[model samples]
Target: MRYCIERLDGQHCLFVDGRKELLIYLKQASSETITDIRKVYRNGVSDSVLEIYLPYRKQ
Candidate 1:
Protein backbone atom coordinates (compact mmCIF):
# COMPACT_ATOMS: atom_id res chain seq x y z
CA MET A 1 0.00 0.00 0.00
CA ARG A 2 0.99 3.59 -0.53
CA TYR A 3 0.65 6.42 1.92
CA CYS A 4 0.59 10.08 1.10
CA ILE A 5 1.61 12.86 3.45
CA GLU A 6 0.60 16.41 2.70
CA ARG A 7 2.39 19.19 4.45
CA LEU A 8 0.49 21.97 6.17
CA ASP A 9 1.66 24.67 3.85
CA GLY A 10 0.68 22.53 0.88
CA GLN A 11 4.19 22.77 -0.32
CA HIS A 12 5.10 19.12 -0.39
CA CYS A 13 3.75 15.62 -0.54
CA LEU A 14 5.58 12.62 0.75
CA PHE A 15 4.79 9.03 -0.07
CA VAL A 16 5.53 6.14 2.19
CA ASP A 17 4.41 2.66 3.02
CA GLY A 18 0.93 2.51 4.34
CA ARG A 19 1.54 1.01 7.76
CA LYS A 20 1.21 1.81 11.40
CA GLU A 21 4.94 1.68 11.82
CA LEU A 22 5.46 4.41 9.27
CA LEU A 23 2.78 6.61 10.82
CA ILE A 24 4.24 6.13 14.25
CA TYR A 25 7.64 7.02 12.94
CA LEU A 26 6.34 10.26 11.52
CA LYS A 27 4.50 11.11 14.71
CA GLN A 28 7.62 10.60 16.69
CA ALA A 29 9.67 12.79 14.40
CA SER A 30 7.09 15.54 14.33
CA SER A 31 7.20 18.54 16.60
CA GLU A 32 4.41 19.60 18.96
CA THR A 33 3.25 22.15 16.44
CA ILE A 34 2.27 19.39 14.06
CA THR A 35 -1.49 19.36 14.52
CA ASP A 36 -4.50 17.98 12.71
CA ILE A 37 -2.83 14.73 11.93
CA ARG A 38 -5.30 12.53 10.12
CA LYS A 39 -5.34 9.18 8.44
CA VAL A 40 -7.02 8.76 5.12
CA TYR A 41 -8.64 5.52 4.02
CA ARG A 42 -10.20 4.25 0.89
CA ASN A 43 -13.43 2.27 1.17
CA GLY A 44 -12.81 1.91 4.90
CA VAL A 45 -9.43 0.39 4.34
CA SER A 46 -6.34 1.91 5.85
CA ASP A 47 -4.65 3.78 3.05
CA SER A 48 -1.55 4.29 5.05
CA VAL A 49 -1.95 7.98 4.35
CA LEU A 50 -1.86 10.96 6.68
CA GLU A 51 -2.61 14.63 6.28
CA ILE A 52 -0.97 16.99 8.76
CA TYR A 53 -1.62 20.66 9.13
CA LEU A 54 1.23 22.21 10.97
CA PRO A 55 1.00 25.54 12.73
CA TYR A 56 1.03 28.28 10.18
CA ARG A 57 4.42 29.70 9.45
CA LYS A 58 5.22 33.26 10.43
CA GLN A 59 5.82 35.61 7.57
Candidate 2:
Protein backbone atom coordinates (compact mmCIF):
# COMPACT_ATOMS: atom_id res chain seq x y z
CA MET A 1 0.00 0.00 0.00
CA ARG A 2 0.99 3.62 -0.58
CA TYR A 3 0.58 6.46 1.88
CA CYS A 4 0.84 10.19 1.39
CA ILE A 5 0.60 13.10 3.83
CA GLU A 6 0.83 16.83 3.27
CA ARG A 7 2.63 19.32 5.41
CA LEU A 8 0.82 21.70 7.79
CA ASP A 9 1.59 24.74 5.68
CA GLY A 10 0.06 23.28 2.54
CA GLN A 11 3.48 23.27 0.93
CA HIS A 12 4.89 19.73 0.63
CA CYS A 13 3.48 16.21 0.76
CA LEU A 14 4.83 13.26 2.75
CA PHE A 15 4.95 9.86 1.09
CA VAL A 16 5.11 6.70 3.14
CA ASP A 17 5.56 3.19 1.80
CA GLY A 18 3.11 0.77 3.44
CA ARG A 19 5.44 -1.31 5.56
CA LYS A 20 4.08 -3.26 8.54
CA GLU A 21 5.12 -0.67 11.11
CA LEU A 22 3.64 2.32 9.31
CA LEU A 23 0.42 0.46 8.60
CA ILE A 24 0.02 -0.25 12.28
CA TYR A 25 0.80 3.31 13.16
CA LEU A 26 -1.77 4.62 10.72
CA LYS A 27 -4.48 2.34 12.00
CA GLN A 28 -3.84 3.02 15.66
CA ALA A 29 -3.31 6.71 15.18
CA SER A 30 -6.66 7.04 13.46
CA SER A 31 -8.47 7.35 16.81
CA GLU A 32 -6.24 10.07 18.19
CA THR A 33 -7.11 13.70 18.78
CA ILE A 34 -6.90 16.48 16.23
CA THR A 35 -7.38 20.19 16.76
CA ASP A 36 -9.16 22.44 14.33
CA ILE A 37 -7.08 22.87 11.20
CA ARG A 38 -7.55 24.16 7.69
CA LYS A 39 -7.83 21.63 4.89
CA VAL A 40 -5.29 22.21 2.20
CA TYR A 41 -4.97 19.21 -0.05
CA ARG A 42 -7.56 16.51 -0.56
CA ASN A 43 -5.39 14.03 -2.45
CA GLY A 44 -2.43 12.01 -1.21
CA VAL A 45 -1.61 14.50 1.53
CA SER A 46 -2.40 15.34 5.16
CA ASP A 47 -2.82 18.49 7.15
CA SER A 48 -1.24 16.89 10.17
CA VAL A 49 0.08 13.57 11.44
CA LEU A 50 -1.43 12.86 14.90
CA GLU A 51 0.98 10.17 16.07
CA ILE A 52 3.50 12.73 17.22
CA TYR A 53 1.08 14.12 19.77
CA LEU A 54 0.10 10.72 21.18
CA PRO A 55 0.62 10.39 24.93
CA TYR A 56 2.44 7.07 24.51
CA ARG A 57 5.32 8.86 22.80
CA LYS A 58 6.44 10.43 26.08
CA GLN A 59 7.69 7.06 27.27
Candidate 3:
Protein backbone atom coordinates (compact mmCIF):
# COMPACT_ATOMS: atom_id res chain seq x y z
CA MET A 1 0.00 0.00 0.00
CA ARG A 2 1.13 3.54 -0.71
CA TYR A 3 1.41 5.93 2.25
CA CYS A 4 1.13 9.70 2.40
CA ILE A 5 0.67 12.72 4.69
CA GLU A 6 -2.33 15.01 5.02
CA ARG A 7 -3.39 18.00 7.08
CA LEU A 8 -6.44 17.09 9.09
CA ASP A 9 -6.75 20.35 11.02
CA GLY A 10 -4.89 23.54 11.90
CA GLN A 11 -2.74 21.77 14.46
CA HIS A 12 -3.13 18.16 13.51
CA CYS A 13 -1.83 15.99 10.68
CA LEU A 14 -2.29 12.51 9.29
CA PHE A 15 -0.18 9.81 7.71
CA VAL A 16 -2.29 7.37 5.78
CA ASP A 17 -2.55 5.00 2.91
CA GLY A 18 -2.97 6.93 -0.27
CA ARG A 19 -6.61 7.35 -1.44
CA LYS A 20 -8.19 6.59 1.93
CA GLU A 21 -9.23 9.05 4.64
CA LEU A 22 -8.45 6.48 7.33
CA LEU A 23 -5.42 8.13 8.88
CA ILE A 24 -3.38 8.73 11.99
CA TYR A 25 -3.61 12.11 13.68
CA LEU A 26 -0.95 13.98 15.59
CA LYS A 27 -1.71 16.89 17.90
CA GLN A 28 0.21 20.19 17.80
CA ALA A 29 1.54 19.53 14.33
CA SER A 30 0.88 20.13 10.64
CA SER A 31 1.91 18.91 7.23
CA GLU A 32 4.75 21.42 7.13
CA THR A 33 6.00 20.23 10.50
CA ILE A 34 6.04 16.61 9.40
CA THR A 35 9.79 16.60 8.82
CA ASP A 36 10.38 17.43 12.48
CA ILE A 37 8.59 14.27 13.58
CA ARG A 38 9.95 10.77 13.64
CA LYS A 39 8.16 7.75 12.19
CA VAL A 40 8.77 4.20 13.30
CA TYR A 41 6.37 1.25 13.30
CA ARG A 42 2.88 1.22 11.82
CA ASN A 43 -0.19 -1.05 12.01
CA GLY A 44 -1.55 -2.21 8.68
CA VAL A 45 -3.52 -5.03 7.09
CA SER A 46 -0.76 -7.59 7.08
CA ASP A 47 2.69 -8.46 8.38
CA SER A 48 4.36 -6.83 5.41
CA VAL A 49 2.39 -3.61 5.85
CA LEU A 50 3.97 -0.74 7.79
CA GLU A 51 3.87 -1.39 11.50
CA ILE A 52 2.89 2.03 12.79
CA TYR A 53 1.98 2.37 16.41
CA LEU A 54 -0.38 4.89 17.97
CA PRO A 55 1.41 5.12 21.26
CA TYR A 56 -0.15 8.34 22.56
CA ARG A 57 -3.62 7.26 21.54
CA LYS A 58 -5.95 6.16 24.32
CA GLN A 59 -7.25 2.66 23.77
Best lDDT among the predictions, by candidate number: 1
Clashing pairs in 3: 41-51, 41-52, 42-51, 42-52, 43-52
What TM-score goes with each of the models?
0.40, 0.32, 0.19
* lDDT tens digits by residue: candidate 1, 1-59: 55555555546555556566445656555543332333556664543212332322221
Per residue, candidate 2 scores C-alpha lDDT tens digits across 1-59 of 44454444446544555445444544554322322222235464535444443443222
For every candidate, C-alpha RMSD to the true structure in Å: 7.2, 8.1, 11.3
Across residues 1-59, which tens digit of lDDT does each residue of candidate 3 receive?
A: 44443233326534554423224443333334442222324563323222352332223
lDDT of 3: 0.36
| TM value for model 2 | 0.32
Give the winner by TM-score: 1
Candidate 3, which segments miss by more than 4 Å at Cα?
Answer: 1-9, 21-59
How many clashing pairs per prediction, in order?
A: 0, 2, 5
Q: Which regions in candidate 1 have their CA more than 4 angstroms from the true location?
A: 31-59
